[model samples]
Target chain A: MDMKRILVYGELEKERLHPVSLELLSKAKEIFPESDVQFGMVLLGSGIDGAVAEAQKSGVDLVYLLDDQRLSVFHPEYFAAALIQAVKAFNPDLLLMGATYGGEELAPALGIRLKTGVAAHCTDLRLTKEGKLAQLVPAFGGKVIGEIFTPNTRPQIASIKPGMFLASPQEDKNASLSILDASLLDSVSQRIRVKGVNRKELSSLPVEKAEVVVCGGYGIGSPENWNSLEQLAGKLGGAVACTRPAIDAGWVGDESSMIGTSGKSIRPKVYIGVGISGATHHICGMKDAGLIVSINSDPNAECFNVSDFKVTGDGNLIVRSLLEALG
Target chain B: MNIIVCVKPVPDPDKYNLLTIDPETKRLVREGIPTVINPSDKNALEEALRLKDLYGAKVSVISMTPLFSVDKIKQCLAMGADEGFVISDRAFGGADTFSTSYTLMKAIEEIGTPDLILAGNESADGATSHVPVQLAEWMSLPHITNVTVTEAFETKLHVRKKTEEGSVDYEIDLPAVLAVERNSNQPRMVTAKGMVAARSKSIRVFAKDDLDVDESLIGLCGSPTQPGELIVPNLKRASQELKGEPEEIAAQIITLIKKSGVAVAV
Candidate 1:
């Protein structure tokens, strides 16, 4: 059997290889074993030597390096042109990229330019009986998973969601490198230009790291219930999270406190959802918690479907009782 | 300046649980569920309206859906879209992002290319975030996705795009596509007066034969990505109802949390 070549687009952030690139590398290995696959990487951007070094030893077979000063900033047309050439050079059967902000933009552009289809936020991937790649994507707002396949396209493209896979680096595996021609980027239009960047200063450890999360939703009623929910989280040494409706209700000050597809996906040891009706988006974020407890007045709250323990009562009474009981 | 905003009529989010799949066709069953203008698309239209206010730009909202959602298009008009266009036809059903973008691109071409095209970063139902980029490719124009802020000028546009860490600013020449992010702005409500005004306005409707479209690349037939077996993720858990009064229930929940190796104050 011929080798099934795979290309992983290694995204760069300030000359460092994005961690998701390594995760994709490991995922590619998990799906297709070493015996039947040849893995390659396409690393772009100026001052990408650190990234190139990282990619060379990450168990891939070849590295296509397209480093240029003009490539320092991500211009869609320029980067897409270089990527199109790099893609043509490697001619892989499968292409994967971290579904980072940049990947989301680049993947679809290539899908159209390469005349192939692209799948985003793929949770799983596998080879079908006929050797086609099946990209598992969430549909209907994370209610179901659909197997997306590009039946007639070459280099079947997909952008895997970050944090879904683990990155176990093989530090000893070194790959040969090839410099891609950058002249194609010359003919590309320079219409889209980067003017500035404003990096946000993160203030605290993210909610995803907390073992216990006290999540409140719109049904939590008033800001007083929200305060009790926060006090409950504090007493338990956990963190406070809110649903999208909570945010929309003005109970949530920022998205940092929100738990949903628009916010964060967390797998905490214990998740207590208060007054949340269990919207599909909110359930997807904290559904994997080890212990799912839902406290809502309505017994028919859809969140009960995924809860390990369901409490049908007053939100305020249950939360206050929980706080007092914990103390 | 002229602007075209791509809007999608999606099933009301509150009724998302009623959504199921037609296993044979792999199409979502949206028959009974009432449709609403996708929330993010509302922000996209809001962004266009803001630009219209700033630059005296003409804003036209477009959608490719069953004609039943004409009310939603009129809702866009009520929200201040100068012109509302719906590309409705049986051929446009069951389209994936590729075909959807191609069809929308063809419609925009028919409407004449505007200086800028805007759309929601992703539809609430699909949430793929693919069409904006694909539409730009089909139209052969530059595009930006997840745009949070935009500043328009005579010959160029400056936009702040949301990234993983923060945001990066970009400048694009005229004739580009922008996929606006949700919550970027508070969308205006459709008032009674706007509704009355929209009632007198006629929305332009296009069918398969209305615009020049390649027969092979219009809908499901044009989409290359086919959906295989669909499975609703099993969210089933131990449905143990913590019985008794609030205090007792709290104790039981605390016990369960403690049993799961969580440390509680008590």
Candidate 2:
């Protein structure tokens, strides 16, 4: 019997594995069930002793630790080189990375170095009858499904988008773990220096985290009327979101507040869409909302299909009418 | 300094009302969809042109798509790229981001490295936001995603990075790859002279053999990921008529929130 091992790259901070790392482990278990699949996680940076122990709890069979200060900040070249070295050494059948900012940048470069194929923004995974890795990805603007297979490559690479998969809870607290030295610290390059790190604070809520969300689209007319939706959201105790059109109109911030495949993926409880025509890119983000209410004047709008409830009338007029009825 | 800008021709998102999928086949029936250069990538091209105006650097454009996209490449040429290259082959079809990046790397190698490379932060079609960073990784160069402002000096590239919460300014060494946000700058319109020049300039076309590349690694056979399903979410809305004054309607909304179990202080 051929052994199939999968390497999941993880970040451990203060002894706790990042949530996405555990999600990868669970997914690997599901894909390679018949083969003897052991989870090998790579931890880069210092103060990860506790993280190594946490990997045991998450069912990681082996942990590769590359403890060094140079890896504290993710530099594409250094990280890619190190990952390439590790993959060459382990020769795992598959490599998985989280679709975070760092992973987005690192996966492709590593793929090029290893001379393998990489599927970006993958939502599902499975193994083919021929024992190759099969990845489910979106194609033609998310309008068509394309089942992709890496027939000629070993260690097929993929970056899984966050929130696409559910992470399984640890069944046992005492799983066996073996720690190995990555020993690739010498390849770290200091060509690029992190002069400073600064984070910004925005006013609107993250669409993904909102319990109730109100989104406006091109049907909102202009940037001036975006405030009306904001007023409505304030009254409803929810946040104001927008489709890709509204973001292009400069009515809302590009990140966090914009709802689409290119922006934030939201799964709010009650999503009230105002004037949104429901483009596929925008609809994919909020399709999981518990109850969706769409309001648009276009009787034949696409947003009507995914919505639980719909109103075919002017958004401003409907908002005003609702406000009046509430009084 | 020489620079290269990569662009993709995608279906204009504004023109199509709703993409129709064959319930049986689950594939988009693209019989009559009008396509255009991706909006964000237009901004990247505009930035490259602005840089050319500032420093008189030569600019080139590259695209990987079907033969039909060459017309869009001509449109890009009219927007002022000194030259253009179109990479099209049957083997390149159904490529995921990783396979796409390898093909792009081959094209870049054929064109030779430049002082800078620019692309849109995300394409409307895939919206993966992975290609630029992946390209940077492949080239072993520094990259700044979601850059709002870009300035080039001797051996240094300065930019304002877009963060989740706010923006931060940073300076990285030159020969870096950048993915510009659509909101960062407005793309300029094509000029008459540029259009005339675009008509005269010849666009170079390449197949799988034009560059030194591994055939198995350049197409669908090499890609590790595949599209499982495309679901057109049902976004239908429920209608209710509110017959009352503005204040009464507002009060009713408040009541509905309370009924829905969302707490309100007022």
Candidate 3:
């Protein structure tokens, strides 16, 4: 039996191997245990020697380094050409990437080039009994899990969502690294240039870092009533957070303020959700909070199921009452 | 200027429902759900149309899906795409992003390189936002993601790329790839004439052999990633009760805050 080789795309950043790369390696190990699972990584950009050293520590058999001044910034065309050339040279059975902004765009484009089934936002992966790739992805806005398989294809490709799998633990510092020169076609007119890269600062007082979090939902109504949540958060020596609806209503910024799938994922010590109906998207963001407290009007709200403490009442009235009681 | 907008048909996010994995079959029970164009891709189409209207460029829509997606191609034509192409094959099933990009790159090569290749920032189904970037890589063309604004110049293009904190402006040469943000522009409606023209337009379909692509490098055989398992996180809520009149309730809230030892300045 021929050994299945797996390739994980993306550069290994200094001090951190891209999470999805580790996840792919982890899944690859599980799927092709008996097969010769040679993990390959593609690193682009200058000053990636540190990254190359880190990739060596991640248990990859070979690292394809495409170090060029033109590859410093993520120019799609150039990177894709390099990747295609690399894949053709070192053919692998599967290609996995992180479902980040860059990964989403890169994955489908690769799918088109390869004329293969490219499953995006895959949350789960496994090998079928018939020895084919089985990818489980969310079918409808995370409402359904669709199991997709490629029985008759050679290299199955997928992009894994962040936080879907655990990044592999640091291995022994002595893993061997083989560096291969990834020949990239040079370009004359690179379309997009990164004039400047600005990183968004996470909230100064992130709810995730807070020992206590006081969150509000749409039931609080009007931005004016937000004062109550602030007061509660202030009293608790914590920060305030809001559901996606509240954030979308322009009541809060993306940082420290919003807690949901699209926003920050938090696990505070004490999380109090006010008037939150406990949608899955919202709950997944903070379900791991140490002590959960929910105050809502609906008796059968899903929030009750996960809360350590439950209060059935209108959010506004209860918040004000709590404020008065605190005083 | 000629443009090719790559669009994909995905299952409607709103209509998605969880299926009970028959522990035995472990397959989704998708019996009665409708699919639609990915929301972001719709925005991409709208942006394409806007560019055409602004500069009178010819726009072609391209996609790769199962044979069932022919209706989606027709819809794209109705929406004002000058032409359409579908790359569908049984062998192409269950490919990852790498293979998908390879297939799309082949189509782009066949369609003849255009001045601009427009795509949505992300698909609702995948929402990874990597396809356009990958397409750019395959074509060896400059590309921009999270595009909010696009202005075509005589010999170059100017665009604003949306970042997490703010937007940055860039001026790139022609023949670039751009992934537009979903909220960048409202897609225009299909005109009556466009509907008629679309009906007359032919959709070009290609198989694995149509493009000079290695079958091993095009599909599952060439993909590197696979989804392992999917467990939908369940949502649970708790309830609280505050018994009192309006003013009394407000006062009670204050008391509760005080009792919790949280500060509340009245």
Candidate 1 lDDT score at position A295: 82
Off by over 4 Å in 3: A1-139, A144-189, A197-202, A207-220, A226-244, A252-262, A274-280, A294-313, A322-327, B17-24, B67-71, B89-91, B164-168, B189-214, B217-266
Identify the leading candidate in terms of TM-score: 1
Sort candidate 1 into its docking category.
medium
For model 2 the TM-score comes to 0.84
Clash pairs of candidate 1? none
DockQ of 2: 0.40
For model 1, how does the per-residue alpha-carbon lDDT over A1-327 read when each residue is reduced to its tens digit? Answer: 233898999988668998779889898888787576889999999988889998998899999999998788777788888888889999987789887778889999998898887888887788788866788998767887889888877778888876567677564778999999878777988788889878776525557778889899988889888899988988888889998888888887667667766667778899998889998888877887889989888989999999988888887898899888877
The sequence of per-residue lDDT tens digits that candidate 3 reaches over residues B160-210 is: 775433455678887888888765777767678777878898899988778
Instruction: Report the C-alpha lDDT of model 1 over B212-239, residue by residue, as the tens digit.
Output: 9997887777887888878778898876
Of the candidates numbered 2 and 3, which has the greater lDDT value? 2
lDDT, model 1, position A167: 79
10 residues in a row with least lDDT, candidate 1 chain B = B21-30
Docking class of 3: acceptable
Better of 1 and 3 by lDDT: 1
TM-score, predicted candidate 3 vs. hidden true structure: 0.69
